[model samples]
Target: MTEFKELYVRKGSVAQDYIDIAQDIYVEINNYFKIIDCNLKFCRMMNKPRTELFGTSILDAIHEKDKIKFQNIIRNALLKKFKDGIIRSDLVDYKSRIIATTMKLNPILDDNNNIVGMFVKFSSFRLRVEDSAVNTIFMSIYNSLTDLYTIYGTDTKIRINHVNTSLLNILGYTRDEMMGRHVADFLVKNKDQEENIKKLFKSLESTGNFTGEVLYQAKNGEEIPIHLSISSLVHNGKVIGSLGIGRDMREQKRLESENKSFELKLQNQSKLAEFGMMLQGVAHNMSTPLTGIKSSAQLQHSRLIKFKDKLAEKYGEDREISDNITDIMKFFELIDQSVSKLSKIIKNMMSKSRDQQSLSKEALNLAYVMNQEIEFLYANQFFKNRVEKNISIQPDLPVIYGLYSDFSQSFVNIIKNGVDAMWDSPVKKMDIVMYYESGAIFVKIKDTGKGIPHDIADKIFDPFFTTKPKFKDAKGEEPNGTGLGLDSVRSLLKPYRAKITFESGPGKGTEFIIAIPVKENQTDLNN
Candidate 1:
C-alpha cells in the first residue's frame, strides 16, 4: 500500500540521519565489518576516495591496539546488546599515521529484524575534555568583553591567528581579513616609528614581554595610538606564541595635549598678572621723580620771577646776577637728572614686556639681558628694598643665539625665584654671576634663604608645583604663585639647547646654574 511504502521511506531516511550525529566521519558497514558506504569525512580520514573506501575492511584503518575493541563494540551493536556502544580508539590512515578518535556504533536491522549491518561514527580527537572546557570558557570571555583589545596565538613568526571582536571592531576589519597576517602589518606604518617598532620587538623577544605605546592603522585609514602589552605564551617550556592586550590611547593623548595647552595659557595669564604688578610699582616709583621735577620747576619759576625784578634793581651788581644765574643752572641740572632716570625706567619696562611675536632667533648679548632684567627687578619694591643683590658680570660676555624674550624671561624668573626664596630669611641676599666659559654662557643665580628640601628638589621644575606663599606687591594686591615660573624657564631654555641645574639643601641656600651654548660662527657683539 502507499502508506506502508511512505513509512518505510521515512524510517530509512531517519536511520541514515543517525550516522551523521556527533561525528565528522561516519560509515555503513556489513556484519562482516567491511565498509559498504561512507561519508566524505570517512574517506578523508582514510586518505582515499569513496571508491577505494567501499568494500574495504574497516579493521584495516583501525590501529592495531584499538582494532579488537572496535570489533567488539561493532559486534555488540549487531547483537543489539548495547544501543549506544562507544569506544575511545585510534585509527591509522593510508599514510600510516595514527589519529586518536572516539567511535560510536549502532545496529542496522533487515525487514525480518535480523542484523544486516552497522553504522559507525568517528569523531577526531582534538582536545581533551578538560582542555575543551577551558577553551570554551576562554572563548566566551574573549568574545564577550568589549573594552579590552586582545590578540591570541600570535606565533613565533608574528603571524596573527586570532583577534577578539574588540580589536576587529576598533580596526574596522573582519576576522577573516586579519587572520594569518603578520602582526607588524597592522602596526608601525610611519617611517619615523620603524626604529621604535624594532626596539619593541627586540625587547619582547629578549624579555618575554613588552609594554609601551604603539601605533596601529585601521582599515578606514585612521591611525590609532595604543598602549599595548604583549606577553609570550609558553607551552611545554617553550615559547610558542604571544598574547597581546591593548588599550586605546587616543582619548588619553588628546586629554594630555589639551592639558598642556591649558597649562601654557595659565602660564601666560600668570605672567600678565605679574607684569601688571610690576607696572604698578614702576608707576609708583616714577611718581617720586615726577613730583620732584614738578616741584623744582615751580620753585625755579617763582625764584626766577623774583630774581628778574631784583635783576633790574641791582643791574650794576654783576656778582648777584652771576650767583642767580648759577642757581638757575643747578635747578636745570636737577630736572635733567629726574628726566633721565624716568627715561631709563621706561626703557627697561619696554624691553622686558616686548611682544612675543617679535621674539625671534638672533644674537643676544648676555650682559644687556642681565642689565635689563636687573633694572626690571628693581620695579618690584620687595626686590629693591628687601633683598640685597650681588651681581657679577664678565665684560664682553659671548653672545648666544635665541629669542630675546626667552632669555629675558628666564633671567627674571630665576632672579624672582631667588628673591622669593629669601622671603623669610634674615640674611636675604641674591647673587647673580654671568660669564663665558667653554664656549657657553654661564649664569649662576644663588639665594641665601630657605633652601629647597631634598625630597622636593627634583620636583621644582614640574608645572603647578610650588611651596611659596602669596606675594603681596606695592599696591597690597596679593597674587598667588602660579607655580609655572621654573617650569616656564625650563620650557623656554629647551629651544636654545640650554641646560639648567640646581644645588640646594634645607636652611643652607639654593643656587641654580644655566648654561647656554653659543653658536660657533657668532662672536660677542660687545667685542
Candidate 2:
C-alpha cells in the first residue's frame, strides 16, 4: 500500500483511487455481458465473493426498465459508434436496490479493431427512479439517437396499453394500430414459448422484473431477434401492466453465427464420420425385409404358375384369372411394407449426415420423437419380433427443450444396444416408463436381456469401448462400434437439466433411469 496526492502517484496508489470512484463499483464483463470481475467496493455492494459473481449475466445487475438504455450504452461503446464512449444508466445490486451511475465501456480490441472484452467503469452513484434519468444524461451526448430504445407497456393480460415513439418506429406500427393488441400478436411463436412467456409473467409478478431474449415479428413479417427486460407496472398497489425495454439483436446474432460457422462445420463433419456406423445398421436392418420378401415372392410365384395352368385348362386362355388373388395380395402387402421400411431407414441415415446447426432448440415432445425412432427399428421385422416392447409414456407429458434429432438418436442408441445384447438371451424385453412428480420428470428404460457385466459396468460409457464382435464398415475395415452411444446419451440430456443413472448385474438385466427437473424448475441450463 502507498499514499498518493493529486500531483504525485505510485504504482498501486491509483488502483484504490479507481475503486473509490462511483462508490467503488468497477466491473468487467465478457462478450455475453457476464461479469468476469469487480472491484472490492462492488464486492461489498454485492455481498458475495468474486467467485460467486463470476459468470453472472450483467443483465441481472441492470434494472429492467433501464436495460435498453444500458444495452445502447455498452453496444455503442463496443462498436466504437460513440466518439467519447460514455453513457449513464442504473445498476441493481444483490439487494435489488437501484443505484444511478455513469458508465463507460472500454473495449478490449483485437488487431482487427473487433471487441474481445469490456472494461466497464461505474461512477456518479444515485438512486434511480425512472428511465428519464438515463435519457437526460445521454440527451446531449446522442442528439440523433431518439429511437435507440424500444419501449412498450403491456397490461396484466399482455395487451399493449402504450407504446413509445421508438417502439412504433422499430415495429413499423402506429400507436393506434398497436394499442389494445396482445403482445404475442407480434411474436413468431416457437414450440412451447407461450408456456415460457407465461412463466415470465409470473416471474414479473413475484420478482417485479424479468430479463431474457426472444424473437419479435416485424410488420413486414420478418423475424427480428431482441433482448428484452420487463418490469411490472403497479396501480393501486396491484399489478396492472408491464414496462418492456428491448434492443434489437439481429446484428449481434448474425456476427455470432458467422464466428461459429467453422466450428459447427467441424462438429458436423465429426458427426458424419460417426454416422458411417449407423449406415451399417441400416444395411443390417434391410436384410430382415429382404429375406422375408424373397421367400414370400418365391412361394407366390409358384402358386401363380399352378393357378395359370388350371385357369388355362378350364377357360380358353386364362380369361378371368381369379384362382388365387387373396394370397397374392398378402404377398404384395409384405413387399409394400418392406419397401417403405427401406425408404425410412435410408432417409434417417441421410439426414444424420447433414449439418443440423440450423435446427432450432425447440421444446420437443419426447414421446413423439421416441416413437418415431422406435418405428424405424420396427422396420426390421427380425428385431421387432425378437424383443418385447412396453412403452407407457404419459398422455400429457411436459415438453423437453432441445434438438429432436439429438434425443431421438440417444434413444435409438440405447434401444439398439439392448437389442444387440439380447441376441443369445431367452428373455428379451424393453420397458419405457415415464412420469412427472414434484417438479421433476422421471424416465425408466429397463431391458430384460443379458445385463452388463458387473466388472465392466463402470466403463460402459467410455468411448470406443465395446464387447461385441466388430461389424465391417462399407470399406471392409471394422471399428469397435465406436462405443460412444452412452457417452452421447449423457451429452444430449445435459441441456435438459437431466442425468442418466444405470443399475446392471451379470444375470439380472439392466435399467437406465433418467431424471429432469420439470419445466417450472428449469434453470441453470441454457435457454
Candidate 3:
C-alpha cells in the first residue's frame, strides 16, 4: 500500500461523521443527496437502494434536460479545483412533471490527493417553477394595464418595460425601435420639449409625481401633443424609478382653437350691428340742426344787407344818425362770424356721419387730421374762452390707414369729453399730441381740469349716460341727447380696428390715447 497509513479507513470515518451531521440538515433543507462509496442515509434521501445509486454518475440520475447543466457545473469544479459548486436550472422529467432545481456539487478526493467523482445534492424544482409562473402572470397583467408605460431611472434615461398597440400606433414606431432610445432623442426637433421633460423628471425626484402637456414628434415628422402623467415608484422609502403615461391631445387642441375663432367672429358681428344703429342716430340729430342753421344764416344775412344800405343812404348827411348806422353795421358783422362758425361744425358732423354709415377706409396723415380737428375746436367761441387747446403733431409720425372722418370724430369726441369734464372747474387747458410707435399711430389728448370721478369712470361710455343737467334750449327745447357721445365714439372705432384708452386721477388730469394699427401702404413721414 506504499505506506498509505490506512488513509481510506480514516477518511471513511470522517465521511461517516459528516454524513451524520448532514442527515439533520438535509431533512430541514428539503433536499436530496447521493453518496458514491458511503452512507445508507444518502441513498434513503434519493428513495433508492444503496447498490442502484452508489456507483452511478450523478448525471445518469438527473432529468435529461438538466443533465448538461449539471455536467458543466461538475466540469467547472474539476477544472477550478473548487471545493463546492452550485448549478441552477429548470427540467421536465419522463413523467411530464416540471422541476425547478439547484444542484450543489462537492468534489471528492482520494487518499493520495487524486480527484475522485463528486457529491451532488439537489432540491425538487416544483416550488421554483410555480413561483416563476406567478411572476409571468404578474408581468402580463402589468403590461395590460399600461398602454405605453416606461420606467425612467433617476438619471432621466428611459427604460421601457411595457407598451400596447395603441401607444405603438400613436408614436408610429415599432416596439424594438423604441426600446433603448433616449426619451429626449425623439423630441430633438423641439428643444423646449426636451428641456421641459428634463425639468419634469427633476420635479418628480422631489415630489414623486408630475403631470403636464408635452409635445412629441412622431416618425412621420408630425408634432403630437400629449398629456404626460408621471408617478415615482419607491422601494424601501427610496425612489427607484418613475412610470409615465401619455395621452394624445392634438385633436382636442384643434377643436378649442376653432371654437375660439368662431366666438371672435360672433363678437365682431354684434359690435358692427350696434355701430350701425348708433351711426343712424348721430346723422339724424346733426342733419336737422345743420339744415336749420344754414337756412337761418342766409335769410339773416340778406335782411341785414338791405337794412345796412337803407340806413347809410338815409343818414348820408346826418352825423349822429351815420354813427348809429356804423354801429348797426358792426352788429351784422358779428352775426356773420357766428354763422360761419356754425357752418364749419355742421360740415364736420356731416362728414363724420357719412363715414360712419359707409365704414369707408383710407390712409391719411394722422398729424394733419389731428391738426384740422384742433383748429376747429379753437375757432369755436364756446371752447375758445373756457379752454386753451394746443396741438403738437409729431413730425416723425407715420400715416394711419383708417376711416378718415371716423378717426377724426373719435379724437374730437375725446377732446370734447375733456372739455365737458371741466365745465364748471377753475382750470382749463387741453393738449393733443400725435405720434407713431411700432407700426401703430397714437393720438394723446390731455386736459388740465378735474378728472372723472373714480366711481363713475367705467360708466362714462354707457349709452344715455351723462353728467350734464337736462335743460330746454333755444331750438324749441332740443330733445335730450341719447348720451351716446363716448358710446358712438367706441362703436365707430370698431370698424377701423382702433383702440381708445384713457388714464385719469381726481384733480390731476385726464389723458386719452387712441392707437390704430399701421398698414403697409401707410406713408412714413419720417422717412
Q: What digit string (tens of lDDT, one per residue) describes model 1 on residues 267-367?
A: 77578757756775786687787767867776776777677668767786577776777678677667767677776676556555653334356776878
Estimated TM-score for each candidate: 0.50, 0.36, 0.35
Q: Number of clashing residue pairs in every model?
A: 0, 0, 1
The true-versus-predicted C-alpha distance at residue 321 of model 3, in Å, is 6.3
Give the best candidate by lDDT: 1
**lDDT by residue for model 3 (1-527), tens:** 22222323355576456654553211111012333453444455455665765545444445777767656666666565454433565444335455566655545456776545554445555445546777788666755663456666655535554455556677888888877567765653556876788787687767778788778788898788878877877789987777788877877886775466446535744675566567557766876776676566566656766766787787655668656756765665666567567666656655544444444456577776676667657666647876876767787576566666666667778887788766657878888888888877788889976887899889888655776645454244222333556776787677556788889989988998888777744644334
Candidate 1 global TM-score: 0.50
Alpha-carbon lDDT, every model: 0.75, 0.68, 0.64
Candidate 3, RMSD to the unseen true structure: 16.5
Better of 1 and 3 by TM-score: 1
**Tens digit of per-residue lDDT, candidate 2, span 37-115:** 7777777778888789899887777889888877776777667675464466777878888887877656665567577
Winner on TM-score between 1 and 2 is 1
